[model samples]
Target chain A: MAMSTASRVRRQLPTSPWLFAAPGLLIIGAFILYPFVSTLVNAFTDRRTLIPGRFVGLANFRELLQDDMFWVGLRNSTLYVVGVVPALVVLPLLLALLVQKNIPGITFFRSAFYTPVVASIVVVGLIWVWLLDERGLVNSLLETIGVGRVGFLSDQWLLLLSAMAVTVWKGLGYYMIIYLAALANVPRELHEAAAVDGAGAIRRFLTVTVPAVRSTMVLVGALSSVAAFKVFSEVYLMAGPSGGPAGEDTTLVMLVQRTGTGLTGRVGYASAISVVVFVVTVALMLLVLRADRRDES
Target chain B: MSVMEKVRPTASRPRTDAREPRVTDENGRRVRVGELVLRYLLLLAVLALTVGPFVWQLSTSLKGPTEDIFSSPPKFLPGDPTLHNYERVADTIPVWDYALNSLKVAAANVATNCVGSALAGYALARLRYRGRRAATLAFVLAMLVPVEGIIIAQFTTMRELGLNNTLIGVVLPGCVSALNVLLMRNAFLNLPYEIEEAAYVDGANVWQRFLRIAVPSVKGTLAVVAIFAFMGAWDDFLWPLIVLSDPSKFTLTIGLNYLHGTFANDERLVAAGTIIAVAPLIALFACLQRYFFRGVGEGAVKG
Candidate 1:
């Protein structure tokens, strides 16, 4: 009887939340938090394989400001983020709307659009290289139309565009599904009401549909921009290690990966590059968030 | 407003006619000629841009080196398509071996990540004890910390564990993915808790309650988690390249990199091997595209 009453008393107590949280906290702290801190410190040091020797302070940062390769990589990364994020946001929305209707063979259409998302970036890159080679199918098709062959994954001017193209292709399905879901969540009666108002479908889309999915567009745009910023696998794989032919396709991430983990053990310099990337990404995210909030207001 | 007022139909029928908006059909569609042409043109352009490379890959992979892919007019299709390049890429490297290695690593990673995530997710979801809010915060924060930042520390850890040159290193750091854990947590949170409590009262332990009640309820989440884990493990190049130095231990992703080293600028074999490497993913996603999207969208929403 005493034990039963004691159990009742125990039941009255609030649950301790720490028991469930500790495991996740411990692992993340070790792997993520610690490393991020170490990288910040590493930004102040010379390129050392094991440990830093002297305090370089802002020397690395100063050098980075003047580094031509750094500027090129940053410029490429920015241009890529600009070019690719728009396609990622827009193409998927278009695809999602086109196929969200209960057309015959909708599943086939969906899969055809989504299959690229599943394929490995490395494979996509390699495959595209052949396809865009001077004698590739695209050029041959163009030749059939009397357009001369142009290097798709090569040529300094087109290299990043090729990477952006593949990025948009491989990732469109993911955001398409997001769009599909948002589109589904839209109350169907809203469309009907608009139709009842004698409004055409185009007016309904602009007035009702677009605003309804504004949050999703904001989200997809932000995430896509971030992914573009870290455009590593495709850039490295499609474009050569030296950032395509003659450094035309280099991004900040590529520079960090190549210089940090390549033949040289410039972990510090690479970490510095990583630091710059982290700052830029965070800054972009903040800017987007601010603009979004402002728009919301 | 001005344009609408100008274009408002002033016919005998009232403007509020209940007639269906036939905007989609070729006849009912009143899209301006310019916009209609632009729409189809843009659609075709994106489609060509998207599918063009794959078509080229298919054609080039079949062509012989003598039939240059870089010819001025570019070969849309191989004159006499051959499996010679495929055979060459397969012969040049241990293609099957690398593929198997990729499968094994991906399998182990999927299994470990799924189990770890499910257990942790349940623990956080229904077993509210203390610090639950803090855990969620940490997970969100952890999500922002990119792979580039932690890769260095993870490398050190692998070296310390003497697993740097093994597949274990390639798979272990990713075993406890925060993203998957949070995904499962959200999924589990969406599940009704009373059923789990009923199991709890029936003398079932936490594991039994989880296995019996939670797993079946969120199998969609599990499958999606599995696909993500599998793809992440499969497509991961940098981690494997960093950890596994031996050629024999190369995963398909790393093996692709090996092609870069071996054939610096040789496009044909690399293209062939690339196609081979990613073929299964293409097939798998083709089979489960909807579920994968269900997972990705929910994954993004919760994330």
Candidate 2:
């Protein structure tokens, strides 16, 4: 047998590299790679439960096209992304601007804000459920101010708004910390120069600070949208797993879970729905990346 | 100490802008003072908004069952504070068992990620290999793939492996975080190549060089990875819920969710369970905040 090109490259490359990457690659292969490929194949079949079913090419996708729940989930997820991303991105930048300054008790404020982020989503949901309950503290405060009780969790529209508020509240400090790190890299002289040129604090922020942190703004935008799109646990805990009344709060992930694990047990159909979820989320990310590049150029 | 140093401004040096008294003294001082006051007020408002809910929950958890948690113009403080709800929570659920399960999953994740990711990252950064670019791109794409999208398949995988309902199954999928791999890779890339080359010249094999040289050099990044892995495993709810059917195998999050579902009427007890679940994570974050904040930027800035 002749020495082959593969053998030549194998000899050239250190085998220790493979030794090093083996454990990581093995686990990722078994878990992520295998599951991803299985999900892809599963989308084409009628597989459900532990029993493997026969292939039904594109049938799941076909049914999904006409599925009303799928469309509702798509709409709700989009609405969630639209409702939450702006505040999650913009408010953090403003908050970072406030806390980035070296002042007394700044760390205390930082920790206080970050406390929510540290808590699990379950805990966050529990606390928010209590806070926004019909006869809860918020309602009591509103009553004291002579306003009627708002059904934050009961009313569908208010439920959606409350979910967004909870997400924004939890995320504000996390993104603020990211922006704080970015703010440190922005040279101080730019602000001083702007000040020397008679620009006020707000003017300095608008002209100098915002522009410097624009990339982080893009980052925050992308991250928050991804998070918003994957809005399951919040809706699950706040609303029920049936995604509240009329399925108004159901995101695509919820739909996938409902189809796969719900009474239906249609794993293939759920896999098909997840394929859509993957496509749409990756598309959203690409759209942001492309827009960011366009802005840069 | 470094966090404190960063937060403290150098006020020891006296002002030297007296020559520009008209510009620096009059308008600047007034405007700065006004801005400072406004900033403090707005920041305090945000602080109250962020921490106020937790405070309310803590109070609610501490209150007696007959205190009327729903009282209008709700009391911020518990008048007759008690640990009755906490006792109820402990009585109701296997809180300690769930906590022990969570700790096992989190510790396993930290160990696996720190060791596996460091090895892979070192190889990718320092060792010559075929398909290195492909490997790196795979990790990046792996990160962008939504976990829920493949969750059904992941469940099937766990079942196939006979690891279902086991803590190992819960920890395996997340053992090597793509983010940490990238973080460690970045940390390794920033290291001076000369040291590794010298070790090689001194007859050190790749493993020896990696262990003695590269691993020691990236302790900070390792700490970051460890914390990230710990928090991720600690905070996970969905995967564990999917994998572990047995309540005995349940993590704290699942236990709390169980409490929420079963004890829907008992708000204070549920609140107590929530606190039990969250308090450790908050304490961990407090201890490792410097590394946590730095880790967030380390990944992002390099990207």
Candidate 3:
């Protein structure tokens, strides 16, 4: 029986890899790949709103390049990618390191920090809206501290800042977990060796600790960057229908939603934005993948 | 070196050599004091920003109906807290029905995503298959590309299948979470193959082997997938909003969203309903925090 099984495996390993992969492959093709290609192709056509319209040419792309809203959306997304991604990357690592201690009641603090990450984006946004309202606790706290009230959600600059703040807050627990898992993989023996060498704490961290978790850092950073691009519900909840004060908090995803479903209703126009978002995200990923792969080799 | 100096590292230098005596110098003594204060201050800032809102929300939920929520110096602590808002919220919507509906959809969704993830992940990790890597990467890439177009198409598909406004409608769309697939696959790949082979040698079937061996080994990953699946399904609003326009069939999420307009945006009622809707997730999360940690860290936006 064992011999027969061994022979069967030998035969199967060589020729059957593709055959076993069909069902899932088909779903991927139908749902993911096809939609992506169709979306890009549809971008070039003249689709009237949510209705089925005819194909036009590069006119959609031309309009996308010329439209001022598209530019604003692009610039805001860029700021978010720059602002939120790094904070998501850094703050979480710091928190994980802090909470990794075995101090009394530290577990409770860890649990509290992570609770927000599990909450829905809409819920978080709604809470943040109340928190940022003119007479909100944030302002009250500021007033108590003798700082005059400043609009956290209304001023355009502060709105983007608040959006990023919420983005960071929701993500802090998540990235901390990533950083925790990554930290777990660092062998205890290495730390002991660094300790034996009279290496100061900073020296040990820089030389041994940081290097061990480099892969995780790359992986976590890249994933968070992509997440920042897909950020939708937060903006929807905070900014209401238009993406936030003066559209400053609008992300690439919000723009796609607005163009696809709302008064704009231009399917081709929205498809063009989708294509652009798709490209931008792909570009961000390629950059990270290339850098990480290069580091690996 | 002084005893206090030997414990905490200076702020500018965060590294604490587990073995080496902590760094100390005559001129740097005052500098260390300032750095220590700054580090604690920054950590305090993080705590205040992150947990402060929940405290305020709790306070607001306790406020009376006519109490000014949008006030001059927004009352952090209501002068008089009451359960009147909670009572009204319970009256406004069938809270139990909404809760049950949410549980039903969320549980069914989690079960489907789990079984789907297990089968798909098993096939990807162990079964000899054609274009497996490419297929896996395709799913990963799909997640990266915008799904706005597909939502409309999903709506169209649901309409065509007569699945709209049904629990199955929500569960079907969630059946194949690609990120869950990647997580399970990565977990399975890391597991020792010898266990499965030993089961194979004993004439155990593939499904039995998976149940006995692979499943037990990847319990952590499964827990992670289950938690996120429940959270994602329970909190989903857009699909339910788009598919079911009827209030009777509404999920808890849609009902909470409805609370605002239903009560004419009465601040207290909305606050009460929002508090009710968000409370369980926060509670469930507190009970099962580790799974969420694993899921978030395991989130894959890569191909």
Check candidate 1 and list the clashing pairs.
A15-B129, A16-B129, A16-B130, A17-B129, A17-B130, A17-B131, A18-B130, A18-B131, A135-B69, A135-B70
Judging by lDDT against the true structure, name the best candidate. 2
Comparing 2 and 3 on lDDT, the stronger one: 2
lDDT of residue A65 for candidate 3: 83
TM-score of candidate 3 on Cα atoms, chains taken together: 0.81
Task: Arrange candidates by TM-score, descending.
Answer: 2, 1, 3
Cα displacement (angstroms), candidate 3, residue B213, comes to 4.2
TM-score for each prediction? 0.85, 0.92, 0.81
Which portions of model 3 show Cα errors greater than 4 Å? A1-31, A48-50, A184-214, A245-249, A262-264, A289-297, B1-45, B66-80, B90-98, B129-153, B156-167, B237-249, B258-265, B300-303
Span of ten consecutive residues with least summed lDDT in model 2 chain A: A1-10
lDDT, candidate 3, residue A94? 74
lDDT value for model 2: 0.84
Q: State residue B226's C-alpha deviation in candidate 1, in Å.
A: 0.9
Chain B, per-candidate TM-score: 0.85, 0.88, 0.83
Model 2 agreement with the true structure over B37-89: per-residue lDDT tens digits = 78789889998899988888899999997898998878889999999998888
- TM-score, model 1 to reference: 0.85
Share of native interface contacts present in candidate 2: 0.64
Candidate 3: residue B87 lDDT (0-100):
87
Instruction: Give a tens-digit lDDT track for model 1, residues B129-212.
Output: 556667777777778887865465566556656887798888877776888889888899999888877776666755567788
